[model samples]
Target: MARDEGGATDSPAAAYVFRVTVRIDPEVEGVWTEPDTFETTVVRAADSPGDPGWLYFRDNLWRGECGDEAHMRAVAEDALGMPVDAIDFRELRTTQAYLDDLRAAMADDLVEFNAETVDAALSKYLGSSIHVTDDI
Candidate 1:
């Protein structure tokens, strides 16, 4: 199991957290109003076991407000220099799901890490790819 900073195991039902970074094109006009990167958490529904149902900040820290799909669309559009309609954010996966995929990619070799579990294997595979939110 994955342990938190306090050394307790992370809840299987807890939200998946991600730190998103988008590079802003300097050619855009006017002063830059937003940071280059932001973090958000996706909460999976208990009944829906496969993926998360909503994306929002743990607190109202994202631009002084919590966000949903609509807000993410606007942020991605501005950051990526594209129209909101042209952007797609469907690929964002939950942390557990991501780890499962990684383990699957390993195939039979995953047996070696079975004792430690897929989460440990994923942590080793993704070394530095994992990021934490600064707000919480």
Candidate 2:
């Protein structure tokens, strides 16, 4: 987890909640029994709001965890309207950053009207579709 110049969390430092839908590989029956969900945190420099810590998984493995990163990325990309490479992963506070971003993005005037709409709007403005999820 990278620290900001102020020796604290950065501007985009927030928790982003993502509903990951794991698609089990047909080759491996019940390889993952259920859809394990989790969140990732991202910290960005207050000055450099666009460059935030991103999260990524390789070979379907995590940081010694059960949840998959690819699933999370897919969901996020769908919501954010951007590529997976756009999101940075932070080690110090992944969950916290994710939640913070989620709250900030959703905490808008239209949140009460529809959560999906807010998400879509955020994705469009933020230029990241990785936060969106399918209607599963």
Best-performing candidate as measured by lDDT: 1
Whole-model lDDT values for every prediction: 0.39, 0.38
* Candidate 2 global CA lDDT score: 0.38
Candidate with the greatest TM-score versus the true structure? 1
Candidate 1, run of 10 with poorest lDDT: 54-63
State every prediction's TM-score relative to the real structure.
0.22, 0.21
After superposing candidate 2 on the true structure, give the runs of residues whose Cα lies further than 4 Å from its correct spot.
2-12, 26-136
Which lDDT tens digits does candidate 2 get at residues 83-104? 4432333322234455355446
Q: Which whole-number lDDT from 0 to 100 does residue 130 have in model 2?
A: 32
Model 1 lDDT tens row, 28-83: 78756466444443332121222343212221122222235466656656654543
lDDT of 1 at 81: 59
Candidate 2, number of clashes? 36
